[model samples]
Target: MPLFGQAAVDQLLEVLDLEQVDAAAFVGESPQTGAQRVFGGQVAGQALVAAGRTVERDRFVHSLHGYFVRPGDPTEPIRFQVETIRDGRSFSVRRSTAQQHGKTIFFMSASFQVREEGLDHHSPAPLDDVPGPDDVPTMLDWVQRYPSRAGIFASAPQAVDVRYVGVPGWVPPGDRVASEEQRVWMRINGTLPDDPLIHACALTYASDLSLLDSVLSVHGEVWGPGGVIGASLDHALWLHRPFRADEWFLYDCTSPSASGSRGLAMGRMFTRDGRHIASAGQEGLLRRIGERKQ
Candidate 1:
């Protein structure tokens, strides 16, 4: 049985829990949030779930690479077709394709592996000089301090709680303060099932939350009016260690470059105790709405 906390998390769990339609296929539905488009992370997580179901339980996901082909209409249910790419002695690879309106919207290739002894080393945790979750302000605190900055995100708390270490991406361009990086402490905001696959999928969903914010932070730009709007083009992740989604983890991200209206962001997640767990990279289209296109 899964531990429980927020109703929002329960809803998120429901969204991640797909309906099996065939031997290697599943159907995922969107919550009626009246949003115009499906969240890229949501589709990616569901696709991971679909792929996970077809693989051996002992094998945990080690890496995934995904490309967002099209925007999905939130009003429609998505169908996932999982293909068994390869199942080697200690590794398994699967490809998941998400389709809506009979058209492919997103697809991912994920590889899983069984436990094995291996030499290991990772970069040191990046938050040694940063404040802990207790010191960082929550969304409510932010709203009270900078209500104007919370334009598109001035809603109720989400299943996943995110606390930025500094100015968030919602800060407009005119008021922007460029930063070298974006740091955040986040978690599911509730208890989750103990399944490793579930935790991995949850992390997959949460990884997309503020990655692009790093790109925005680079130039002190925000999202929305007077700022820039964007969409994720691709997301990739590599998990090096096991972690629980319900536990607070630090996500440290930065943007190395931007050109031709595209920005690339890279990030890593470390446990509160300072174990480096995963690394994520994404490239997205970041275009200013007021700017004219050729």
Candidate 2:
């Protein structure tokens, strides 16, 4: 069974409730890879679950900082060890380390604050004049259109629905261009519970998709047979407000720098109404075939 499927993730969520410290130790193993690595979103989501379990229901997570150290093996179970850094009247802090085979694969620190009204100021949301997810073609539809490159989409986990305004590189150019920015509509494929922590985790998982590719867009390198190799090195996110994961969210991404075989990209996630819900930044290893020697 796929570790990233809806049923698998749902089952994993049941085993890894954040309230009990022992539940934090719950790890979902991949039946295919047999590697002990945990899913990046899973770790982020589970960590948020762990932190949320400790705080009052009214106080939601406002921000989180995490680092990915190594690829988790799916075969082995990941142990989530939690640390209560501080507890205060208005704020609480917690740190978690996800370990596999006794090796730390990921580390995270999250802060929660009691809900309070405050002055708000933010830049106007970007113009989403483009078509919405339903208006655009589903990623799966595109994959089927090009059966030869179906493996790429086939390998992706099915927890989220991805609709690309610009077709992925693997597909033959059917009205596509290499732009510095990429737009996509994303949301949980299924109805997610109202738990804010679950929404945050779902966002974290969705954040990683296509972020690095934004960097590739700058160089006109889309994923294909001759495309460059890219993998995320580090990911950071800041949640600004509360939102639903099951609803369509717009992700606008841009690449500011690509040098020394590394690319940096930043993203802003917004609700359909243009409210800024969260911000994300990532740096990754981008290397093109044959270009590495030159």
Candidate 3:
């Protein structure tokens, strides 16, 4: 079933609340891959939620670092183990490992801090002139244009509303341009509860969506012949400020390097008003494939 919209988001929140552990143990056995692969964003968001639960309510997650060890099995339940790494006066740290079928699939370290006064400084916000997610075409509308490739969009949990600033090139390849950056507008598809943790986790999930493609764009390889075998290997994020997830935010991504069959991309997320809320960085394996072998 399509995992997006209100139903899916509500179900995910239910699971999150009912299985309220210091860590998350989710089972996502892919009916397609037949492998129990944990979704990287899910693990990351769940880990952040776990860490947030342990800290004071006012203390929000400020940064997180995670590694993808092995492809997770979606069919089997994932066990999340959380370690309280540090609890200082202003900062707290926690480490979490997501395991499935007796094997580690994801590991993450997160830091939380009580909101405090600091010299606020950030790079000039990008895409302040772009329209919000509402003004752009919904992802579902785009998916209908290519029913055959709908699986990719359908498989994703649709808690988020993603609108590409430009036409998506997943099928019938769009204009291939060589640039080091890409832009997309995103926001929660439904009203999120007031819990700050939920907002943080939601942001965690949204951050992983399309940042890596910025790297591929630089080589004119995005949606290349047979497309690129792109997979995120590691993801890191630094939250600079707090904001509502349901509000429209622009994700401006840039690629600084691509070598050794790996590409590094960084993103800065900003509210429509030009407030820099968070920054994300990721490195992924981008191997060009000759044909659809998977």
Candidate 4:
């Protein structure tokens, strides 16, 4: 087992660098992120890495769809088995499944395509006069303000710098419920090498952090003693342009609907300067536990 020291970015890069165990199978270990279960984004990103390793360099990944079958054990290593579904003249498709203890935990289907020019357009990024990442409070600040949750917040993965654009669910202000939308500015905490695949994978890992929370914002729910219970069920991503993970990007997230014990969230990634870079969507199990509100 490899330890990722104190740097979150280093740990992420290490985990993404999988060890080839067979022609189409690879093994990856979890980082010491202090969570009971493995992060869903980590598995998705790593699975994409496994598939990308088997792909030709000329083709870059454009989209991926994945499902979370079961919670992953952080103490155990995950094995990724990739299957080549097709390889066309300009596109390739691959399916990757992640397993632990001989049981499937996560699976993904990814598509890659060669560079080509086409009509290009995107939704305009938000124009709110939001504070920059530096001006916003860090997780450490939250831990200090809310000492009861210090251990949990302090132990979270520190690979990315996250600055919430609004008050987080755990920290409410004067009973004012959060708006339907949630925004955060995030990027790799430290500098990363110039590898496009590594950048893409790192962004994928960061994308999952606050998506579901957007749904909670709508219902004035928080993750406290009697908060809501939620877990991601499935996720998908579409890359629109090339970008670096080390630079600041605003993750604008919102929930469109919640029903049948599930919630759907959609997000768009934009550079600080307003370049729409990517889009992500996820559906998660969102159940209200404990006593219902009267």
Best by lDDT: 1
lDDT ranking, best first:
1, 4, 3, 2
- Residues 37-75, model 1: lDDT tens digits: 898889999999999999989999999999999998988
Estimate every model's Cα lDDT from 0 to 1: 0.90, 0.72, 0.76, 0.85
Per-residue C-alpha lDDT of model 3 across residues 118-168, encoded as one tens digit per residue: 697888886646666777778888788766655567566677788987655
Off by over 4 Å in 2: 1-26, 30-38, 155-157, 169-176, 290-294
What ranges in model 1 sit over 4 Å off? 1-5, 146-152
Question: Of the candidates shown, which would achieve the greatest TM-score relative to the real structure?
Answer: 1
Name the weakest run of 10 consecutive residues (lDDT summed) in model 1: 148-157
TM-score of every candidate relative to the true structure: 0.95, 0.86, 0.88, 0.93
1-294: candidate 4 lDDT, tens digit per residue: 222223767877888999999879999999766788999989998999999999999898889999999999999999999999999999999999999999999999999999999999888888467788888888667767776744445666678787788766666334438588988898888888997778888888988888888888888877655676678999999989999989999999999999888899999999988899999999998766674433
User: Which pairs clash (backbone N, Cα, C closer than 3 Å) in model 1?
Assistant: none
Model 4, stretches more than 4 Å misplaced?
1-6, 172-176, 291-294
Cα RMSD (angstroms) for every candidate in the order listed:
2.7, 3.3, 3.2, 3.0
